[model samples]
Target: MTGWRRRETKREEQIIRVLQEPPEAIDLRGARRWRWADEHWRVWLRRSATGVELFTRWQESDEYRYMLGDDAYQMQLIEILTRATPRDCAAAGFGCTRRMDRACSEPSICSRDPLPAAGVDPHREGPVPGGCDSFYGGDDVRVRFSAGNRHQAVRWSMSLWIDGVRVGAGLRLASSGWWLDDRFFVVPAEGPDEHPAQEYTMGDLVSVIHSVLIHDAALSVTRVLVPGPEEMWTEPWVVRDGDELRVYPDQETSRGPDRTIVLTD
Candidate 1:
């Protein structure tokens, strides 16, 4: 059973009232309410009539929307663009597509020999001196990188950027992914226009990196936070540059010499 619930403050009552039966314009101008959003209903409020109206949307489905009444608490047509844009999932392969803000950075990363036999769990703790290996660490962390066109994983304070674009929290791999939710990033300027940032799936991220490497030759991933294995923390990544990006799993970041970048989870 849940514990006793806290009583709603007057402000909370005001906000709830705004959602059900919206007030008039004068009320809207005077009333101030916080926006509501969660995993279920991405709820929001905006001015309407005299008070406000409430609107909610499903994250998994774009076609679904809920409205309360003539009085509204949702944003106007212009601000709706953010909620209207669809999640880009064209490149999801062998893994689930995710919003950059929702990805979990599990400390323990499952690593396996680059070429393991058919049915082995990749989570084997210690590697054979020179074989593949998994890793471990704490959760809730953000790693920074100095990257360029020959791209690498990216992050920011509240947005995750890959190849100069915003991406969701999920950068899912075979086992898990980076917890880049709320991280921040910036899109490099191209020609005369500044790039607009948005989220990208893992596949999309890989594809964009490839494109940047081959086509955007002029750009180098600046201040990139390389996506290390789940077990990475201030570790040196054994990057294998080839047709495909390969970040070999290693504990160098934790045990490496002082010269290596030392970051805490």
Candidate 2:
């Protein structure tokens, strides 16, 4: 009887332990809920009566990590293109195609080595370093030049100009050997005859600018001013040039000069 009782107690304790521990599987039914779907964690953000609610589904898997890593890389590219300046873009190889190929490859590991340095072989043809053409919107921007020997962190700068007048400058920091995600906005002239506000995607400009800056040893104009939208009176534009511009924008200007640039996580 004593032995039987002891065995029963142990079984009871085990059951209690299982119950006490947090559940590996979660029930997502609340306003903002995340759950496992298609072998991946799904996150949701819902608007509640009062405000907004957020939820997430936790998944422990390597594949999930890979997806997250890819997402991070894409976000980094966006940030670099948006916030980084011409010098920052050139040094970091913001729009180099060859470097992008290597960076996106299996061995590159987006976290370890984001962009290749200038002169360093990206192990591809076309150009050694990369170039920047125009700032648009996208997930991927090729980086050709290496980040120098320090390999400590990624650095970029931005100098805003209005009508050839320098207004402001910005600096960006990112993980070593990793590309930083950024975004940029440019407003040219407010007129009907000027070239319609041209949107240059980072992916499109990186290769051309990378080659021009890194290999060609030339400082070219990566950004140009054009007519903004008809509805909007003044438009702020992102400019990428080899040499830093003197004129920029006034942050406190009432003309909606305030620009919000960020990296999407």
Candidate 3:
């Protein structure tokens, strides 16, 4: 007998971008394989016997082979292969607007805008930060930052970028963010490191905490009731109030510190 089946609901279909065909310089035939698989990305190199044929799966999903025609990327991959260690794989500096895999199935679908040329400063200068938790929006107007580092007191520096420009330097705290619009983004901020135990009835670590951080296109950041109130660490409820967005401390009352963030452009 067949197992039980559920009816499928109609949903919007997403368009996945197909990578361009490889140039003549990169010949995949008879290439040496050097693979490195990790939790986030499963990357491997196809070294050409005579010329530059280096491929990386970290750029997109497993279906296609994305190759960089440049000799620099080829050399970098060779150096990492020579070391042949997990530490070397973790430390490898391969940069692109998006790593292509994680939350989104397709890199093109995940990134809302067209990615800039190879080695281009799509967001900020120098090298991109390590361990990117998630990508929001697109390369043009996007929010890229790390989250889920609650165990550590301090985390790597992260920041929001808009049109190749960094916003408000970088933040050390881990936070989950949502891009409300092209100009505004919101995050359920992880409160400060040191919370005194005596302040709450259930104690500091045991009691839940909540805070909100908002950023605008002008680089102005507004934090609402950061650290929250003592013993009232319940999750806040967000409601649409006229043209603005208001966050109540708890579902029980609409009164508290207001926590109102203006949404008007």
Best by lDDT: 3
Candidate RMSDs in Å, in order, are 19.9, 18.7, 18.2
Better of 1 and 3 by lDDT: 3
Best TM-score among the predictions, by candidate number: 3
Give the CA lDDT, 0 to 100, for residue 61 in model 3. 20
lDDT of 3 by residue, 65-180 (tens): 23554444433433323322211222222332244222323322222222233112213211222332233222221233212211111111244333333333434322334444
Q: Estimate each model's TM-score.
A: 0.19, 0.19, 0.35
Predict model 3's lDDT versus the native.
Answer: 0.34
Which candidate would rank higher by lDDT, 2 or 3? Answer: 3
With candidate 1 superimposed using the best TM-score fit, by how many Å does residue 48's alpha carbon deviate from the native?
23
Provide the lowest-lDDT 10-residue window in model 2: 208-217
Candidate 2 vs candidate 3: the TM-score winner is 3
Cα-based lDDT at residue 166, candidate 2: 32
lDDT of 2 by residue, 1-265 (tens): 9999999999999989999988554443432232212111111111111111101101122343466775564343334333333223323222333343221121112212224443242122222222222211123222222223211112222223222223223211111111111222222321333324433223322111110111111221223322234322222323223332211232223444222322222
lDDT of 2 at 94: 25
